[model samples]
Target: MKAAAIFGPGDVRVMDIEKPEPGPGELLVEVKACGLCSSELGMWVDPNFKTDDPIFFGHEVSGNVVAAGAGVSKFAVGDRVTIFTDRGGYAEFVTVPEDWAIKLADHVPYDWALGEPIGCAMNGTSRSGIEVGDTVVLIGIGFMGGLIQQGARLKGASRIIAVDTRPESFELAQKLGADHVIDAREGNAIQRILELTGGEGADVVIEATGKQGALDMATEAVRIRGRLVIFGYHQGGKRTIDVQAWNWKGLDVINAHERDPQAYLKGIRTGMKLLEAGQLDIAPLLSHYFELKDINHAFLLAKSKPDGFLKAVITF
Candidate 1:
């Protein structure tokens, strides 16, 4: 089978490799689609990210079960499923534990079945403790932030404020149910939110942009004693935070990334419910697609994020 492997920064190549088999309580899935995250962009370029040459990557996946190992009973060979953490989703085939694959809804398309991120967003929403009349501020209107906006709106957030530098993001955020949009590049994002919230700041502030500056802005934008949710993938590198402000404000800071499989599965189910119930629509977010052979190009596009590039995915 042919699989795309990352040799190093900006050097990805497709190679003919032996397909992996399912071990006990695992399933061999023929991947149909996979989504790329921003973290991969850093991995593709940053030399400090030590790894074996041509590392197996791409965790966001949706596929059909081709083979099941011993002790696998919940799924069969023909089940159409979206994988949570099945390894090497960039390839044509990936082997994951039986519990990692969730059966997809009949109406869900294969491409849109990349549900791990969605589940993570759902988990963020749940951990956020967003109330019916809460004023929510989400900094960085990317894919995860947009979905969180939808989730906040669905939860009856009185005001959903979106902040992004891109003009297109404002339009998309409004369409996704944000009540207010702030151009981060225009001026002080913290000031605008403070003004919008009448100097009290928001009830819940989420930093979905992993950038340190954005995180600083979120800390300033959150109200005293309000919850601040960190929903972005801050994979590596250490950064400083304003410990004095945190101590003074009495802010409830929460790291909303879900590491447990059971937590992810629960969020996946909730995300599926939102999709089925019409509360969350991901059609607009999937802005680019590429074939397996064009995997390197896809990564480039995702990294550069040219105009109108909301997200990209690889299709089998």
Candidate 2:
């Protein structure tokens, strides 16, 4: 089996490795597609980042079950699924616990069935507590953010305001059901969100850029008692927040990242159901695709984020 092993920053090599077999209560999936997540970009670009082992990486995966280990009765050898595995997805095969794998409808393509990030978006939406007719502001309309925008609309948000620096993002956000868009480069995103919310801030503000500026804007663009959902994958270093302002505003701040495997599994199940029902479409967000041999190139493109790029997937 061929697999990608990162030796250091900017150094990814494809090497022949032994394919892993499923353990008890696990399913061995033949890799069909895996997404290149921004969260792992540090491993490819940050020179200071170090890893004890590099064999198991790339988590967003969708494939066909090739073998079912003992006690795995929920799925069979021929089942198609989007799996959650902390193993090497950038390979010919990977094994996941049966509980972490969700069925993929026949209609959903393998490349677009990026279960992990889709689950993340769904979990974030659930934590947002978006009530019907609530004004929702989403800062940073990237891949996950765009999905969240769609989820927000389905959650019955009265008005969806999208904030991003890219013009393409504004267009996509509108297409995804955002009622208004703000250019973050204009230096008045907070004010614009306030204006759109009728002098009061939005009912719920979500920061999805994973940047300090977007986080600051989200904090300021929420109403006194509104919920602020941090849905972004913040990396690199620590961030500073205005604690005094949060204390005074009586805001409900929620970090929307899920650590518990059960929570992630639940979100994946819900997201897959939504995808099967045609309630969510991720076709447009998959902007780039690469073969497993070109994993390094895929990482470079994801890190640089060339024009028209949203998300990159490595296909078997």
Judged by lDDT, which candidate is best? 2
Model 1 score (lDDT): 0.86
lDDT of each: 0.86, 0.90
- Cα-based lDDT at residue 224, candidate 2: 94
lDDT of 2 by residue, 1-316 (tens): 9888887888888888888889999999999999999988888887876665665688999999999999998999899999998887888999999988998999989997888999999999999999999999999998999899988988989999999998778878977878889998899888888778788899999999899988888889999999999998898799999988888889999999899988988888888999999999888777898999898999899888888888999998
> What total of clashing residue pairs does each candidate reach?
0, 0
Lowest-scoring 10 consecutive residues by lDDT in candidate 2?
48-57
Ten contiguous residues minimizing lDDT sum, candidate 1: 45-54
lDDT of 1 by residue, 1-316 (tens): 9788787877778889999989999999999999987778887877766556668788889899999999998999999988877467889999989888888877888887777888988889889999999999998887888888888878779999999998768888988878889999988888889999999999999999888988898889999999988887775688689989988999999999877889998998888777867678898788899998898899888888899888899999
Note the residue pairs that clash in candidate 1. none
> What's each prediction's TM-score?
0.94, 0.97
